[model samples]
Target: MTEPEVSDSLKTFGVVLKALRDETGLTQEEFAHRVGYSPGYVAKIEQGKRFPPRDLAERAEPVLGPLAAKLLRAAARSLTRKVGLASWFHEWAAIEEEAVSLYAYECRVIPGLLQPEPYIRAIFERRLPPLSEEQFESQVAARLARQSLLEERPNSSFTFMIEQALLERRLGGDATTDALIDNLLTQGARRNVEVQIMPLRQEDHFGAGGPMYLAETPSNQWIGYFEGHDSSLLQTDRKAVSSMLRRYDKMRAQALSPRDSASLLEQMRGAQ
Candidate 1:
Protein backbone atom coordinates (compact mmCIF):
# COMPACT_ATOMS: atom_id res chain seq x y z
CA MET A 1 0.00 0.00 0.00
CA THR A 2 1.00 3.60 -0.53
CA GLU A 3 2.18 5.85 2.26
CA PRO A 4 -1.15 7.51 2.83
CA GLU A 5 -2.97 4.26 3.62
CA VAL A 6 -0.10 2.52 5.37
CA SER A 7 1.77 5.33 7.03
CA ASP A 8 0.75 4.42 10.56
CA SER A 9 1.54 0.74 10.11
CA LEU A 10 4.96 1.59 8.77
CA LYS A 11 5.64 3.83 11.71
CA THR A 12 4.42 1.20 14.17
CA PHE A 13 6.73 -1.37 12.63
CA GLY A 14 9.58 1.08 12.94
CA VAL A 15 8.81 1.53 16.62
CA VAL A 16 8.86 -2.21 17.17
CA LEU A 17 12.11 -2.61 15.30
CA LYS A 18 13.76 0.28 17.09
CA ALA A 19 12.64 -1.05 20.47
CA LEU A 20 14.10 -4.43 19.72
CA ARG A 21 17.35 -2.87 18.62
CA ASP A 22 17.52 -0.79 21.76
CA GLU A 23 16.75 -3.76 23.98
CA THR A 24 19.55 -5.72 22.34
CA GLY A 25 21.88 -2.70 22.51
CA LEU A 26 22.80 -3.01 18.87
CA THR A 27 24.03 -0.02 16.90
CA GLN A 28 22.21 0.54 13.62
CA GLU A 29 25.31 -0.64 11.77
CA GLU A 30 25.52 -3.79 13.82
CA PHE A 31 21.80 -4.52 13.69
CA ALA A 32 21.77 -3.87 9.95
CA HIS A 33 24.55 -6.40 9.53
CA ARG A 34 22.54 -8.99 11.46
CA VAL A 35 19.39 -8.21 9.47
CA GLY A 36 21.29 -8.20 6.13
CA TYR A 37 20.27 -4.68 5.23
CA SER A 38 22.53 -1.77 4.46
CA PRO A 39 22.87 0.48 7.52
CA GLY A 40 21.45 3.42 5.58
CA TYR A 41 18.36 1.45 4.56
CA VAL A 42 17.84 0.17 8.10
CA ALA A 43 18.16 3.70 9.39
CA LYS A 44 15.50 4.89 6.97
CA ILE A 45 13.17 2.11 8.05
CA GLU A 46 13.83 2.85 11.69
CA GLN A 47 13.04 6.52 11.07
CA GLY A 48 9.69 5.51 9.47
CA LYS A 49 10.72 6.85 6.06
CA ARG A 50 10.50 3.35 4.56
CA PHE A 51 8.59 0.12 5.18
CA PRO A 52 10.27 -3.18 5.73
CA PRO A 53 10.06 -5.45 2.72
CA ARG A 54 9.37 -9.18 2.87
CA ASP A 55 13.07 -9.87 2.29
CA LEU A 56 13.93 -7.64 5.18
CA ALA A 57 11.30 -9.33 7.32
CA GLU A 58 12.87 -12.66 6.53
CA ARG A 59 16.30 -11.44 7.48
CA ALA A 60 14.88 -9.97 10.70
CA GLU A 61 13.14 -13.21 11.65
CA PRO A 62 16.43 -14.90 12.41
CA VAL A 63 17.72 -12.08 14.60
CA LEU A 64 14.39 -11.05 16.16
CA GLY A 65 13.14 -14.65 15.79
CA PRO A 66 9.59 -15.92 15.40
CA LEU A 67 7.98 -14.61 18.59
CA ALA A 68 8.68 -10.95 17.92
CA ALA A 69 7.68 -11.15 14.27
CA LYS A 70 4.50 -12.97 15.22
CA LEU A 71 3.48 -10.13 17.50
CA LEU A 72 4.50 -7.57 14.89
CA ARG A 73 2.51 -9.27 12.16
CA ALA A 74 -0.54 -9.23 14.42
CA ALA A 75 0.08 -5.54 15.01
CA ALA A 76 0.52 -5.02 11.26
CA ARG A 77 -2.81 -6.67 10.52
CA SER A 78 -4.61 -4.65 13.20
CA LEU A 79 -3.03 -1.42 12.03
CA THR A 80 -4.20 -2.05 8.45
CA ARG A 81 -7.65 -3.48 9.18
CA LYS A 82 -9.65 -0.25 9.14
CA VAL A 83 -8.59 2.02 6.34
CA GLY A 84 -9.69 5.27 7.97
CA LEU A 85 -8.31 4.24 11.35
CA ALA A 86 -4.61 4.93 11.22
CA SER A 87 -2.13 2.28 12.26
CA TRP A 88 -0.94 4.58 14.99
CA PHE A 89 -4.34 4.20 16.65
CA HIS A 90 -3.77 0.48 17.00
CA GLU A 91 -0.37 1.18 18.49
CA TRP A 92 -1.99 3.79 20.72
CA ALA A 93 -4.51 1.20 21.84
CA ALA A 94 -1.59 -1.00 22.77
CA ILE A 95 0.05 1.87 24.58
CA GLU A 96 -3.14 2.66 26.43
CA GLU A 97 -3.10 -0.87 27.73
CA GLU A 98 0.16 -0.15 29.52
CA ALA A 99 0.24 3.62 29.94
CA VAL A 100 1.19 5.11 33.26
CA SER A 101 -0.50 8.44 32.55
CA LEU A 102 -2.95 9.87 30.02
CA TYR A 103 -4.05 13.44 29.46
CA ALA A 104 -6.68 14.44 26.90
CA TYR A 105 -8.33 17.64 25.73
CA GLU A 106 -11.63 17.49 23.84
CA CYS A 107 -13.70 20.14 22.11
CA ARG A 108 -16.59 18.06 20.85
CA VAL A 109 -17.33 14.91 22.85
CA ILE A 110 -16.10 13.04 25.92
CA PRO A 111 -12.93 11.06 25.51
CA GLY A 112 -13.46 7.35 24.84
CA LEU A 113 -11.46 6.54 27.92
CA LEU A 114 -14.15 8.25 29.97
CA GLN A 115 -17.26 7.06 28.12
CA PRO A 116 -19.65 4.39 29.34
CA GLU A 117 -20.68 1.34 27.35
CA PRO A 118 -24.22 2.49 26.62
CA TYR A 119 -23.02 5.93 25.61
CA ILE A 120 -20.37 4.43 23.39
CA ARG A 121 -23.01 2.21 21.80
CA ALA A 122 -25.17 5.24 21.24
CA ILE A 123 -22.26 6.97 19.56
CA PHE A 124 -21.68 3.97 17.33
CA GLU A 125 -25.36 3.72 16.52
CA ARG A 126 -25.12 7.20 15.05
CA ARG A 127 -22.35 6.31 12.63
CA LEU A 128 -23.18 6.90 8.96
CA PRO A 129 -22.06 3.56 7.58
CA PRO A 130 -24.44 1.78 9.98
CA LEU A 131 -22.83 -1.13 11.67
CA SER A 132 -24.52 -4.49 12.00
CA GLU A 133 -26.09 -5.05 15.40
CA GLU A 134 -23.48 -7.67 16.20
CA GLN A 135 -20.73 -5.34 15.14
CA PHE A 136 -22.24 -2.57 17.18
CA GLU A 137 -22.33 -4.70 20.31
CA SER A 138 -18.79 -5.90 19.73
CA GLN A 139 -17.53 -2.35 19.36
CA VAL A 140 -19.39 -1.26 22.44
CA ALA A 141 -17.86 -4.11 24.37
CA ALA A 142 -14.40 -3.22 23.10
CA ARG A 143 -14.88 0.42 24.02
CA LEU A 144 -16.06 -0.54 27.46
CA ALA A 145 -13.13 -2.88 27.94
CA ARG A 146 -10.95 0.19 27.52
CA GLN A 147 -12.58 1.74 30.59
CA SER A 148 -10.97 -0.92 32.71
CA LEU A 149 -7.92 1.28 32.83
CA LEU A 150 -9.86 3.65 35.02
CA GLU A 151 -10.90 0.97 37.49
CA GLU A 152 -7.88 -1.31 37.58
CA ARG A 153 -5.63 -1.21 40.60
CA PRO A 154 -2.60 0.97 40.18
CA ASN A 155 -4.74 2.72 37.59
CA SER A 156 -3.09 5.09 35.18
CA SER A 157 -3.36 8.75 36.04
CA PHE A 158 -6.17 10.19 33.90
CA THR A 159 -6.88 13.84 33.22
CA PHE A 160 -9.36 15.47 30.87
CA MET A 161 -9.88 19.08 29.87
CA ILE A 162 -13.18 19.29 28.00
CA GLU A 163 -14.98 22.28 26.55
CA GLN A 164 -18.35 23.26 28.01
CA ALA A 165 -19.88 23.18 24.54
CA LEU A 166 -19.43 19.43 24.49
CA LEU A 167 -21.62 19.08 27.56
CA GLU A 168 -24.25 21.21 25.86
CA ARG A 169 -24.15 19.24 22.64
CA ARG A 170 -26.83 16.91 24.07
CA LEU A 171 -25.69 13.79 22.33
CA GLY A 172 -28.47 11.18 22.49
CA GLY A 173 -30.69 13.88 23.94
CA ASP A 174 -31.00 15.40 27.41
CA ALA A 175 -31.37 12.24 29.45
CA THR A 176 -28.45 10.51 27.80
CA THR A 177 -26.26 13.58 28.15
CA ASP A 178 -27.21 13.80 31.79
CA ALA A 179 -26.34 10.20 32.32
CA LEU A 180 -23.07 10.69 30.53
CA ILE A 181 -22.21 13.69 32.63
CA ASP A 182 -23.12 11.83 35.79
CA ASN A 183 -20.82 9.03 34.73
CA LEU A 184 -18.05 11.49 34.07
CA LEU A 185 -18.56 13.03 37.48
CA THR A 186 -18.46 9.64 39.14
CA GLN A 187 -15.36 8.57 37.21
CA GLY A 188 -13.67 11.83 38.04
CA ALA A 189 -14.09 11.04 41.71
CA ARG A 190 -11.70 8.17 41.28
CA ARG A 191 -8.29 8.58 42.87
CA ASN A 192 -6.50 8.55 39.54
CA VAL A 193 -8.82 10.73 37.50
CA GLU A 194 -8.68 14.53 37.22
CA VAL A 195 -11.45 16.04 35.13
CA GLN A 196 -11.67 19.69 34.17
CA ILE A 197 -14.30 21.67 32.32
CA MET A 198 -13.59 24.75 30.19
CA PRO A 199 -16.56 27.08 30.14
CA LEU A 200 -17.88 28.37 26.83
CA ARG A 201 -17.25 32.03 27.71
CA GLN A 202 -13.63 31.47 28.62
CA GLU A 203 -11.16 33.67 26.80
CA ASP A 204 -7.55 33.22 25.82
CA HIS A 205 -7.90 29.46 25.71
CA PHE A 206 -5.69 26.80 24.26
CA GLY A 207 -6.80 23.88 22.02
CA ALA A 208 -9.26 26.21 20.28
CA GLY A 209 -8.16 24.59 17.08
CA GLY A 210 -9.08 20.93 17.89
CA PRO A 211 -8.58 17.99 20.21
CA MET A 212 -5.41 16.18 21.14
CA TYR A 213 -4.15 13.63 23.64
CA LEU A 214 -0.73 13.31 25.21
CA ALA A 215 0.21 9.94 26.63
CA GLU A 216 3.24 8.97 28.64
CA THR A 217 4.51 5.45 28.31
CA PRO A 218 5.71 3.44 31.28
CA SER A 219 9.24 4.29 30.22
CA ASN A 220 8.29 8.01 30.06
CA GLN A 221 8.40 8.54 26.29
CA TRP A 222 5.69 10.98 25.25
CA ILE A 223 3.54 10.59 22.15
CA GLY A 224 0.79 12.82 20.83
CA TYR A 225 -2.35 11.64 19.03
CA PHE A 226 -4.83 13.68 17.00
CA GLU A 227 -7.73 12.43 14.95
CA GLY A 228 -9.06 13.64 11.62
CA HIS A 229 -12.09 12.61 9.58
CA ASP A 230 -10.64 9.42 8.17
CA SER A 231 -7.44 8.93 10.12
CA SER A 232 -5.46 9.70 13.25
CA LEU A 233 -1.84 10.72 13.56
CA LEU A 234 0.55 9.51 16.23
CA GLN A 235 3.23 12.15 16.49
CA THR A 236 6.57 11.18 17.96
CA ASP A 237 8.28 14.28 16.67
CA ARG A 238 9.59 16.10 19.71
CA LYS A 239 8.64 19.54 18.44
CA ALA A 240 5.04 18.58 17.58
CA VAL A 241 4.58 16.85 20.92
CA SER A 242 5.99 19.92 22.67
CA SER A 243 3.52 22.24 20.90
CA MET A 244 0.55 20.11 21.97
CA LEU A 245 1.87 19.93 25.49
CA ARG A 246 1.99 23.73 25.57
CA ARG A 247 -1.56 24.01 24.28
CA TYR A 248 -2.81 21.49 26.84
CA ASP A 249 -1.06 23.47 29.53
CA LYS A 250 -2.93 26.57 28.41
CA MET A 251 -6.25 24.70 28.37
CA ARG A 252 -5.64 23.38 31.85
CA ALA A 253 -4.93 26.89 33.04
CA GLN A 254 -8.22 28.13 31.61
CA ALA A 255 -10.31 25.22 32.81
CA LEU A 256 -12.08 24.74 36.12
CA SER A 257 -10.11 22.69 38.56
CA PRO A 258 -11.13 19.05 38.96
CA ARG A 259 -13.06 19.66 42.18
CA ASP A 260 -15.04 22.51 40.63
CA SER A 261 -15.45 20.70 37.34
CA ALA A 262 -17.37 17.98 39.12
CA SER A 263 -19.43 20.68 40.83
CA LEU A 264 -20.13 22.19 37.42
CA LEU A 265 -21.33 18.86 36.18
CA GLU A 266 -23.61 18.57 39.19
CA GLN A 267 -24.97 22.06 38.66
CA MET A 268 -25.62 21.33 35.01
CA ARG A 269 -27.43 18.17 36.01
CA GLY A 270 -29.71 20.15 38.32
CA ALA A 271 -30.32 22.78 35.66
CA GLN A 272 -31.31 20.08 33.20
Candidate 2:
Protein backbone atom coordinates (compact mmCIF):
# COMPACT_ATOMS: atom_id res chain seq x y z
CA MET A 1 0.00 0.00 0.00
CA THR A 2 1.25 3.44 -0.91
CA GLU A 3 -0.07 7.01 -0.89
CA PRO A 4 -3.03 8.58 -2.74
CA GLU A 5 -3.02 8.05 -6.53
CA VAL A 6 -3.73 11.64 -7.54
CA SER A 7 -1.17 12.79 -10.13
CA ASP A 8 0.19 16.34 -10.37
CA SER A 9 -2.04 17.18 -13.33
CA LEU A 10 -5.07 15.57 -11.71
CA LYS A 11 -4.45 17.40 -8.46
CA THR A 12 -4.28 20.73 -10.24
CA PHE A 13 -7.52 19.97 -12.10
CA GLY A 14 -9.25 19.20 -8.84
CA VAL A 15 -7.88 22.33 -7.20
CA VAL A 16 -9.25 24.48 -10.01
CA LEU A 17 -12.59 22.67 -10.06
CA LYS A 18 -13.03 23.07 -6.33
CA ALA A 19 -11.95 26.68 -6.45
CA LEU A 20 -14.44 27.53 -9.18
CA ARG A 21 -17.15 25.62 -7.39
CA ASP A 22 -16.46 27.45 -4.13
CA GLU A 23 -16.20 30.83 -5.81
CA THR A 24 -19.68 30.30 -7.26
CA GLY A 25 -20.91 29.24 -3.78
CA LEU A 26 -22.71 26.18 -5.14
CA THR A 27 -22.88 23.00 -3.11
CA GLN A 28 -21.75 19.79 -4.80
CA GLU A 29 -25.34 18.75 -5.39
CA GLU A 30 -26.24 22.13 -6.90
CA PHE A 31 -23.24 22.03 -9.19
CA ALA A 32 -24.06 18.47 -10.23
CA HIS A 33 -27.55 19.53 -11.24
CA ARG A 34 -26.17 22.36 -13.30
CA VAL A 35 -23.64 20.04 -14.94
CA GLY A 36 -26.02 17.11 -15.48
CA TYR A 37 -24.07 14.70 -13.23
CA SER A 38 -24.45 13.22 -9.77
CA PRO A 39 -23.14 15.03 -6.70
CA GLY A 40 -20.86 12.11 -5.82
CA TYR A 41 -19.39 12.11 -9.33
CA VAL A 42 -18.80 15.83 -9.08
CA ALA A 43 -17.07 15.34 -5.73
CA LYS A 44 -14.74 12.76 -7.23
CA ILE A 45 -13.85 15.17 -10.02
CA GLU A 46 -12.99 17.80 -7.43
CA GLN A 47 -11.04 15.30 -5.30
CA GLY A 48 -9.22 13.92 -8.32
CA LYS A 49 -10.34 10.40 -7.50
CA ARG A 50 -12.16 10.27 -10.85
CA PHE A 51 -11.26 11.89 -14.12
CA PRO A 52 -13.08 14.94 -15.39
CA PRO A 53 -15.10 13.94 -18.45
CA ARG A 54 -14.14 15.95 -21.55
CA ASP A 55 -17.43 17.82 -21.77
CA LEU A 56 -17.19 19.05 -18.17
CA ALA A 57 -15.76 22.38 -19.32
CA GLU A 58 -18.75 22.95 -21.60
CA ARG A 59 -21.18 22.10 -18.84
CA ALA A 60 -19.45 24.37 -16.33
CA GLU A 61 -19.10 27.49 -18.48
CA PRO A 62 -22.74 28.48 -18.32
CA VAL A 63 -23.26 27.59 -14.67
CA LEU A 64 -20.06 29.11 -13.26
CA GLY A 65 -19.92 32.12 -15.66
CA PRO A 66 -17.35 33.07 -18.35
CA LEU A 67 -14.43 33.41 -15.97
CA ALA A 68 -15.03 29.86 -14.75
CA ALA A 69 -14.48 28.61 -18.30
CA LYS A 70 -10.95 29.99 -18.30
CA LEU A 71 -10.07 28.11 -15.10
CA LEU A 72 -11.60 24.88 -16.33
CA ARG A 73 -9.66 25.12 -19.58
CA ALA A 74 -6.42 25.58 -17.69
CA ALA A 75 -7.24 22.55 -15.56
CA ALA A 76 -8.20 20.57 -18.64
CA ARG A 77 -4.77 21.16 -20.18
CA SER A 78 -3.08 18.51 -18.01
CA LEU A 79 -5.98 16.15 -17.22
CA THR A 80 -5.46 12.37 -17.01
CA ARG A 81 -7.97 9.77 -15.78
CA LYS A 82 -8.04 8.64 -12.12
CA VAL A 83 -10.55 5.79 -12.07
CA GLY A 84 -7.61 3.28 -11.76
CA LEU A 85 -9.33 0.66 -13.92
CA ALA A 86 -7.88 -1.03 -16.98
CA SER A 87 -8.34 0.77 -20.28
CA TRP A 88 -10.97 -1.71 -21.46
CA PHE A 89 -12.95 -1.31 -18.22
CA HIS A 90 -12.81 2.46 -18.66
CA GLU A 91 -14.46 2.03 -22.09
CA TRP A 92 -17.20 -0.21 -20.73
CA ALA A 93 -17.85 2.17 -17.83
CA ALA A 94 -18.14 5.10 -20.24
CA ILE A 95 -20.75 3.14 -22.18
CA GLU A 96 -22.65 2.36 -18.98
CA GLU A 97 -22.92 6.05 -18.22
CA GLU A 98 -24.84 6.74 -21.44
CA ALA A 99 -26.57 3.40 -21.90
CA VAL A 100 -30.31 3.58 -22.32
CA SER A 101 -30.72 0.04 -20.98
CA LEU A 102 -28.34 -2.17 -19.03
CA TYR A 103 -28.46 -5.79 -17.90
CA ALA A 104 -25.94 -7.39 -15.53
CA TYR A 105 -25.74 -11.02 -14.38
CA GLU A 106 -23.24 -12.30 -11.85
CA CYS A 107 -22.42 -15.61 -10.15
CA ARG A 108 -19.18 -14.67 -8.44
CA VAL A 109 -19.93 -11.65 -6.22
CA ILE A 110 -22.44 -8.88 -5.84
CA PRO A 111 -22.61 -6.65 -8.87
CA GLY A 112 -20.49 -3.57 -8.22
CA LEU A 113 -23.40 -1.16 -8.66
CA LEU A 114 -25.42 -2.75 -5.86
CA GLN A 115 -22.64 -3.34 -3.35
CA PRO A 116 -22.29 -1.26 -0.19
CA GLU A 117 -18.96 0.24 0.79
CA PRO A 118 -18.28 -2.53 3.29
CA TYR A 119 -18.89 -5.22 0.71
CA ILE A 120 -16.84 -3.33 -1.83
CA ARG A 121 -13.99 -2.98 0.67
CA ALA A 122 -14.12 -6.68 1.45
CA ILE A 123 -13.80 -7.59 -2.22
CA PHE A 124 -10.80 -5.36 -2.85
CA GLU A 125 -9.09 -6.27 0.38
CA ARG A 126 -8.71 -9.83 -0.90
CA ARG A 127 -7.14 -9.09 -4.29
CA LEU A 128 -4.32 -11.57 -5.07
CA PRO A 129 -1.48 -9.17 -5.75
CA PRO A 130 -2.93 -6.67 -3.26
CA LEU A 131 -3.77 -3.07 -4.07
CA SER A 132 -1.80 -0.16 -2.68
CA GLU A 133 -3.54 1.97 -0.08
CA GLU A 134 -4.19 4.54 -2.78
CA GLN A 135 -5.18 1.99 -5.42
CA PHE A 136 -7.60 0.43 -2.99
CA GLU A 137 -9.22 3.75 -2.19
CA SER A 138 -9.38 4.80 -5.84
CA GLN A 139 -10.95 1.48 -6.85
CA VAL A 140 -13.62 1.88 -4.22
CA ALA A 141 -14.33 5.44 -5.30
CA ALA A 142 -14.62 4.42 -8.96
CA ARG A 143 -17.11 1.68 -8.12
CA LEU A 144 -19.21 3.89 -5.86
CA ALA A 145 -19.13 6.55 -8.59
CA ARG A 146 -20.49 4.00 -11.04
CA GLN A 147 -23.24 3.07 -8.60
CA SER A 148 -24.47 6.66 -8.74
CA LEU A 149 -25.53 5.91 -12.29
CA LEU A 150 -28.59 4.07 -11.04
CA GLU A 151 -29.89 7.29 -9.48
CA GLU A 152 -28.39 9.72 -11.97
CA ARG A 153 -30.22 8.33 -15.01
CA PRO A 154 -33.83 7.99 -13.98
CA ASN A 155 -35.08 7.10 -17.43
CA SER A 156 -32.54 4.37 -18.07
CA SER A 157 -33.63 0.79 -17.34
CA PHE A 158 -31.25 -1.27 -15.17
CA THR A 159 -31.72 -4.90 -14.20
CA PHE A 160 -29.32 -7.01 -12.15
CA MET A 161 -29.47 -10.79 -11.76
CA ILE A 162 -27.40 -12.27 -8.93
CA GLU A 163 -26.76 -15.86 -7.99
CA GLN A 164 -28.40 -16.83 -4.68
CA ALA A 165 -25.16 -18.26 -3.33
CA LEU A 166 -23.51 -14.87 -3.48
CA LEU A 167 -26.17 -13.41 -1.23
CA GLU A 168 -25.89 -16.23 1.31
CA ARG A 169 -22.08 -16.36 1.35
CA ARG A 170 -21.67 -13.29 3.56
CA LEU A 171 -18.15 -12.60 2.39
CA GLY A 172 -17.44 -10.06 5.10
CA GLY A 173 -19.66 -11.74 7.69
CA ASP A 174 -23.03 -10.69 9.13
CA ALA A 175 -22.50 -6.95 9.40
CA THR A 176 -21.44 -6.64 5.79
CA THR A 177 -24.29 -8.87 4.64
CA ASP A 178 -26.76 -6.70 6.52
CA ALA A 179 -25.37 -3.61 4.84
CA LEU A 180 -25.39 -5.36 1.47
CA ILE A 181 -29.04 -6.37 1.71
CA ASP A 182 -30.04 -2.91 2.83
CA ASN A 183 -28.26 -1.32 -0.11
CA LEU A 184 -29.78 -3.81 -2.54
CA LEU A 185 -33.28 -3.22 -1.24
CA THR A 186 -32.85 0.51 -1.36
CA GLN A 187 -31.54 0.41 -4.93
CA GLY A 188 -34.09 -2.15 -6.13
CA ALA A 189 -36.88 0.06 -4.90
CA ARG A 190 -36.00 2.57 -7.58
CA ARG A 191 -38.51 2.57 -10.44
CA ASN A 192 -35.90 2.26 -13.15
CA VAL A 193 -34.01 -0.62 -11.52
CA GLU A 194 -34.87 -4.31 -11.15
CA VAL A 195 -33.19 -6.92 -8.96
CA GLN A 196 -33.59 -10.65 -9.50
CA ILE A 197 -32.00 -13.65 -7.87
CA MET A 198 -31.19 -16.94 -9.59
CA PRO A 199 -32.57 -19.39 -7.07
CA LEU A 200 -30.29 -22.08 -5.74
CA ARG A 201 -32.60 -24.94 -6.67
CA GLN A 202 -32.81 -24.08 -10.33
CA GLU A 203 -31.13 -26.89 -12.23
CA ASP A 204 -31.24 -24.97 -15.46
CA HIS A 205 -29.64 -21.54 -15.34
CA PHE A 206 -28.91 -19.72 -18.55
CA GLY A 207 -26.43 -17.52 -16.75
CA ALA A 208 -24.40 -20.60 -15.98
CA GLY A 209 -22.55 -19.52 -19.07
CA GLY A 210 -20.86 -17.13 -16.62
CA PRO A 211 -21.23 -13.42 -15.79
CA MET A 212 -22.04 -11.02 -18.61
CA TYR A 213 -23.14 -7.44 -19.19
CA LEU A 214 -25.32 -6.09 -21.97
CA ALA A 215 -26.22 -2.54 -22.75
CA GLU A 216 -28.23 -0.67 -25.35
CA THR A 217 -26.49 2.52 -26.38
CA PRO A 218 -28.27 5.84 -26.79
CA SER A 219 -28.40 5.18 -30.53
CA ASN A 220 -30.24 1.87 -29.89
CA GLN A 221 -27.18 -0.11 -30.91
CA TRP A 222 -26.55 -3.04 -28.55
CA ILE A 223 -23.25 -4.48 -27.32
CA GLY A 224 -22.02 -7.13 -24.90
CA TYR A 225 -19.04 -7.14 -22.52
CA PHE A 226 -17.17 -10.13 -21.14
CA GLU A 227 -14.16 -10.19 -18.85
CA GLY A 228 -11.56 -12.87 -18.22
CA HIS A 229 -8.51 -12.75 -15.97
CA ASP A 230 -7.16 -9.24 -16.40
CA SER A 231 -8.62 -8.62 -19.85
CA SER A 232 -12.08 -7.93 -21.27
CA LEU A 233 -13.81 -7.93 -24.61
CA LEU A 234 -16.30 -5.35 -25.80
CA GLN A 235 -18.29 -7.31 -28.34
CA THR A 236 -20.03 -5.41 -31.12
CA ASP A 237 -20.44 -8.34 -33.46
CA ARG A 238 -24.18 -8.53 -34.07
CA LYS A 239 -24.31 -12.30 -33.57
CA ALA A 240 -22.39 -12.22 -30.28
CA VAL A 241 -24.48 -9.41 -28.91
CA SER A 242 -27.65 -11.25 -29.98
CA SER A 243 -26.55 -14.40 -28.18
CA MET A 244 -25.83 -12.55 -24.93
CA LEU A 245 -29.18 -10.81 -25.18
CA ARG A 246 -30.93 -14.13 -25.65
CA ARG A 247 -29.24 -15.63 -22.59
CA TYR A 248 -30.18 -12.54 -20.60
CA ASP A 249 -33.77 -12.93 -21.70
CA LYS A 250 -33.83 -16.56 -20.57
CA MET A 251 -32.13 -15.78 -17.25
CA ARG A 252 -34.61 -13.03 -16.58
CA ALA A 253 -37.38 -15.57 -16.95
CA GLN A 254 -35.76 -18.15 -14.67
CA ALA A 255 -34.65 -15.87 -11.83
CA LEU A 256 -37.06 -14.94 -9.06
CA SER A 257 -39.16 -11.90 -9.81
CA PRO A 258 -38.15 -8.58 -8.30
CA ARG A 259 -40.84 -8.78 -5.65
CA ASP A 260 -39.89 -12.32 -4.69
CA SER A 261 -36.24 -11.40 -4.79
CA ALA A 262 -36.75 -8.62 -2.28
CA SER A 263 -38.64 -10.97 -0.03
CA LEU A 264 -35.89 -13.53 -0.31
CA LEU A 265 -33.29 -10.95 0.68
CA GLU A 266 -35.37 -9.90 3.64
CA GLN A 267 -35.69 -13.49 4.73
CA MET A 268 -31.93 -13.88 4.55
CA ARG A 269 -31.22 -10.71 6.54
CA GLY A 270 -30.64 -12.58 9.79
CA ALA A 271 -30.79 -16.24 8.76
CA GLN A 272 -27.01 -16.54 8.99
* TM agreement with the true structure for every prediction: 0.69, 0.75
For each of the candidates, give the backbone clash count.
Answer: 0, 1
Candidate 2: Cα lDDT at 176 = 91
Q: Write the per-residue lDDT of candidate 1 for residues 78-114, one digit (tens) a residue.
A: 3333223324455676556556788899986789878
Best candidate (score: TM-score): 2
Give candidate 2's whole-model lDDT.
0.84
List the global CA lDDT of all models.
0.73, 0.84
Q: Give the TM-score of candidate 1.
A: 0.69
For residue 43, model 1's alpha carbon misses the true position, in angstroms, by 35
Q: How many backbone overlaps does candidate 2 show?
A: 1
